[model samples]
Target: MRRVLIIGGGVAGCATALALHRAGFAPVVFEGHPDSGEDIGAFLTLAANGMAALRELDAAIAVGRAGFPLHTLEFAGGVRELAGHRCLRRAELCRVLQAEVARRGIPLHHGKRLASAAEDADGITARFTDSGIARGDVLIGADGLNSRVRALVSPGAKPRYAGQQVFYGYSRPRRPPCEPGRIVMVRGEAAFGFAVSPGGETYWFARVSTVESPEPSWRESLLALLDKDCAAIVAATRGPVLGTNARDLAQIPRWRTDRMLLIGDAAHAASPATGQGASMALEDAVVLAKAMRDTANPLEVYEQLRRPRVEYNTEASGRMSARLPPMDVPPPVSEEELAGQLDWSRRVELTAAE
Candidate 1:
C-alpha cells in the first residue's frame, strides 16, 4: 500500500488521512494536541460540497451524529443571504473524523508536535518535537491557518489577516426556541452576528473591523465585545463560549514543492465572510486525494486542481471582506442591491461516496 504521513491531525489533517486511506493509502495522522478531544471550540459550516467530501471519507454519518444537520444559510447584513450551508459543531465534527479514522484503522499520534520537515527525491520525513522522525512516500500538511509545514516549504508564504477579528463562543440553552435549525444573522454597525449549530445550542460569533486578530487574551475581550455586538446572543448562548477571536487568513501563491503537497488551510484559507471555510477545506482534502490517486505525477495535478479552487474561494472571501460595514454602522445597502448580490457557492457532485 502507498504510505503517506499527515502532519497536524486537526480537521484538515484527519480529513486528509481519511481520504488518503480510502484511496488505498496507509496514512498516519500526527496531531499536536494531547488527545483527540480537546478544548478547541468552533462551529464549522458543513456546506454540501464539504458534506459530500466527508461522506467520501466515510465520516459524514458520524459527523451528523455529532451535531445537527445544517438546513439553511442566511446572511443578515441589512438581512441578505450571501451563502448558506448545513452547518455543524467543529468539536463534534472532529470527533466524527476521529471515529472514521479509527474505523479504518488509520493510525493517529497525538502530542507529537511537529518541529520541521524535509523532502528528498525518494521520500519525505517529518521531525517532531521529541526529535522523532516519521517518513513516508509523500507528506501532506493538513495543519491549519498557521501551518508549520508550509513555512518550511515556502518561507515566503504567510497567512495575512483579512482586516477583521471575531469573538465567539458556544452556550447551552439559557433560552430555548431561539428558533432551532435556523441560522440567524444580525447585521449591525461595524459588526455582524450569526448563530447556528447542533442540539439547539447557538455558536455565536461577531466579527469586528480591526487590523490585528485577537490574541490569547481575546476570550475576555470577546466577552465584552460580544456584549456590545449582540446581547441576545451573549445571553442565549449563555456562559463558557469557545471564545475564538475570528481572524481569516490568505495564503501566498505557490502551494507545492517537490513531492510534498499542502491541503486545506495549509494551501489557502477563507474568511467566514463566505461561510464556507470548513466546506472548502473538506473540498481541498478530497480534491488533493483524488489528484494523488489518479496521477503518478501528482505535484502538477495537485497544483492544477487546488489553485483555481483556492483562488476562487480567496477571491470570493476578499469580496466579502470588502462588503463588511463600518464596525459601528451597517453599510447603506439597498434591498435591491443586496438582493442582486451573486451567490458564489459551488454545486457539488453529491455522489462522491459515503
Candidate 2:
C-alpha cells in the first residue's frame, strides 16, 4: 500500500485525505492547530463550482445538510443579482469537513506543523516542528498560502498583499428580523457585504484598503467608514470582528517534484474576490486523488492539468482587486463586468483525471 502524507488539516488537507482514502490510498493528515474541532473564522460562500467539487468527493451532501445555500447574491445593494450562491459559517464548514474525515477513519494529526520536507528516489519524508517525522510514498502540500512545502519546492515564490483588508462578523437583530435567501453587497467608502443564512443569522463582511490592520474596534472602525445605509447593517450587529489580510500569489512556476505534490493554496492562492479559494482546494483534492489512482506519475499529471486553471483564477482575482475604487467612490468595474467575473467563478467544475 502506498501511504500518503498530507499537510494542513483545513479544507484542502481534509478533502485530500477523504479523496485519497476513497481511492484506496492510506493518507495521514497533519495540521498545525492543536484541536480536531477548531473552527474559528469568518463566513464564506461555496459557489456552484465549490459545491460540485464537494459532491464529487461525496462531501457536499453532508456540508449542505449542515450549511444553507444561497438562492441569490445581490451586488451593490441589488444592482445585480447572481443566482446559485450559498453561504456557510467558516467554523461550521471546517467542523463538518473534519467530521467527514473522521467518519472515514483517516488519520489526522493536529499540532503537527510541517517544518521541512526531504525527498529521495524511494519516497518523501516530512519533518514537523515538534520534532516528529512522517514517511510516505508521496507528500501532498495543502498547507495554504504560506506553505513550507511550497518553499521547499520553489523558494522564490511568495504571496503578495492584495491591498485590501476585511472584517467579518455575525449579527442578530430583534428590531429588524434577518431575512434569508438574499446576499446584499454595498460598495461605497468601503465594500460591505451581508447575507441572511437559512438559519436566520446575518453574516456580514467589510472590506477596506488599509494596509495596516485596524485595532480591536474593527467593527466600529468599519461602521464609521461605511456609508449611512451600509453602516446601519453593521451598527445593528453584535459580535467581535474577525479581521484577515487579503493576499494573492499571482502564480507559481513549480507545483511539484518527483516525490512531492502541492495542492490548494500552496500551489495557487486566489483573492477572496473570486470566492473560489475553497472550491479550488476541493477541486484539487478530488482531481489529485483520482490522478494518483489512475497514473503512475500522478504529480506530473496533477500539475499539468491544475496549474493553468488555478493561474487563470489567480490572475483574474488580481485584476479584480486592482480595479476596486477608493473609499466613498464608485466601483471601478461596472455591473456587467462584475457579472462576468461571477459567471466565470460559478461555471468552474471539476474534471476526473484522465
Q: Pick the candidate with the highest TM-score.
A: 2
| TM-score on alpha carbons, each prediction | 0.81, 0.86
Off by over 4 Å in 1: 37-39, 74-85, 172-177, 196-199, 213-229, 243-245, 324-354
In model 2, the Cα lDDT at residue 316 comes to: 73
Per-residue lDDT over 88-113 for candidate 1, one digit per residue giving the tens place of the 0 to 100 score: 66776777787778878999988887
Model 2: colliding residue pairs? 70-86, 189-328
lDDT (tens digit, per residue) of candidate 2 on 69-166: 67766664354455545688777777888999889899888989888888888888899999999999898888888888898888899998887787
The deviation in Å at residue 100 for candidate 1 is: 1.2
Error of 1 at 275 (Å): 1.8
Q: Tell me how far the alpha carbon of residue 28 in candidate 2 is from the true structure, in angstroms, after superposition.
A: 0.8
Provide the lowest-lDDT 10-residue window in model 2. Answer: 341-350
